[model samples]
Every structure is written in C-alpha cells, then in structure tokens.
Target: MDNYGGHIGQGRARDSQARRDAVTVEIGYALCSALFLAVVVFGVVAGPALAFELSDTVQGTLVASGATLGAVLFTVRVVSVLNRFAREGDSTDGDQPSQPGRTNPDS
Candidate 1:
C-alpha cells in the first residue's frame, strides 16, 4: 500500500511537469511569432542602417519563415506535452476501465 501511494505521487508529479511544459511551449510560440513580426518591421524601417545587401523583401520573408517554423514546432511540442499529461493522468485515475488483458498497473 505504501509503494502504491509512492507510485501515485510520482505519477501526479509527472503530469504536473507535463502541464507546465505545455504552457511554457505555448508562451514560447507566442513570443517567437511576435519576435518575427518585430524583425520584419525592423528590417523595413531600418533597412538603410542595416545595409547588409539584404533586401527588405528577403529579410521579411526570412523572418516570416523563421517565425512560422518556430510557431509550428512550438505548437507540436505543446500538443505532445498536453497529450503526455493526459495519458499520465488517465493512467493514474482508477475510475476508467482498463484495457482487456493488459497489465497496466497504473490504470
């Protein structure tokens, strides 16, 4: 009984960590998207000062691409984290019916 209680505690911690990770990923995604927009604006407004032979169009495109890629990756991370948390939570909750013939001690 003591061992079972310990396992349950560990499972709860894991689920909590997953939820935190999901929220962090969401915040990161939002920050990256905002940064991408800021970069585009900076490139347009400070093009003359930057003088890197990089056209505003090219800079804008690159920034937009980076932002989009970051957003997609972050979104995937957030989804995965949330899924993990839910899976762990479900396994921890004994209210749900267990699968047939499977020895999922946590479920």
Candidate 2:
C-alpha cells in the first residue's frame, strides 16, 4: 500500500516486508551517498596537502579541516535523506487504521 502519497501504495499494508525492504534500501542508499559525498569533500579540501610542499603545521591543519568538513557533510547528507524518507512514509497518509487494537465497528 502506497499511502506515502495518500493513496500511493494501493492496498499494501504498512507493516509489510516489502515496506521494510524499501526502508532498508533507502537506508543503504543514504549511507553510500553520504560516504561518497564525504570522500569527495574531504578530497577537495585536503587534496592540496597531498599535492603541495607546505609546512607540516599547514598540512596537518588542512587535513584536519578536510576531515572535519567531510564528516559534517556526511552527517548532514544522511540525516537529510532519512528525514525525507520518513516524512514521505508518515502514517498520516491515512493508511493506518482509524483506531488501533480494535476492529472497525462499521466494518
């Protein structure tokens, strides 16, 4: 059931294994993308150190800054992606039972 869009799932239950799989795949994508982003950012920031003949302190500082920035970007990417996924999967899409732990009396 694609309630992520108020009617997207089409009869799929919210707790189905397929839904779980989708969540898993989304998480994997977030992780991989974040890692790729972090590495690229780190390389862009720290690459100078690897290519230049700067003093030890400057090289160290650049490396540190690169690592820090990369980590920050990685966190941001993962969080933003997961948050988007969560917002899209909200039970407020109306797929959830009107009341839990009870049968619908009108059924």
Candidate 3:
C-alpha cells in the first residue's frame, strides 16, 4: 500500500537523521576534548611564568585555582568514563546481576 511505503520512507529518513546527529555529537566531543587538552597544556607550560610576574598573594591564589580546576576536571573525566563503562556493561550483559555479591533469586 502507498501508506506502508510512506511509513517505510519516513523510518529510513529518521534513521539517517539519527546517524547524522550521532556523528555530529562525536565530532563535537572530539573538538571539545582537544580544546581542553590544549588549555591544560598551555596552563602547565605558562602558568608559572605568568604567576611569577604577579605578587606573592596573587601567585598563590592563581596556583590554588589552577590546582582546584585540574582536580575537578580529572575527577569529572574519571566519573564519566566509569559511568560509560557501567552503561555499556549493562547493555551487553542483559538481565545479569551487576553486583558481584548479589545472587539471582532464580538460581
């Protein structure tokens, strides 16, 4: 029927759009990650040089701020990777008990 053909066409179009959107998201993520790395590298190489030109109090504050930022970023990345791994594991191992100590009631 014409309606069935139209529905199929719509589904294919949706699938194509979803793929394009996913690729765009991946590219954006890569760009942002590269930018973050560049910023961190620049901070590591230039932070001390810039701080030396400032007063002791200002230098200390800048160092503290940089350290805090680095720690927070590192923590965020670690948590994100862990969460992703957890989700992937769940998807690949359907219905299995996720926790090691938890036994399946039917077993």
Best by lDDT: 2
Per-residue lDDT of candidate 3, residues 39-63 (tens digit) = 6954884498575787878777777
User: Considering every candidate listed, which one attains the maximal TM-score?
Assistant: 2
- How well does candidate 2 score on lDDT at residue 72? 96
Q: Candidate 1, residues 4-24: lDDT per residue as tens digits?
A: 566447866765797688768
What TM-score, over all chains together, does every model reach? 0.39, 0.72, 0.44
- Model 2 has an lDDT value of 0.84
lDDT of 2 by residue, 1-107 (tens): 23245565544554477678988999999999999999999999999998999999999999999999999999999999999999978845544555688763224
lDDT of each: 0.61, 0.84, 0.62
Model 2: residues with Cα > 4 Å off, grouped in runs: 1-15, 91-107
- Model 2: ten consecutive residues of lowest lDDT: 1-10
Model 1 misplacement above 4 A:
1-53, 94-107
lDDT of 3 at 26: 56
Which is superior by TM-score, 2 or 3?
2
Rank the candidate models, highest lDDT first. 2, 3, 1
Pairs in steric clash, model 1: none
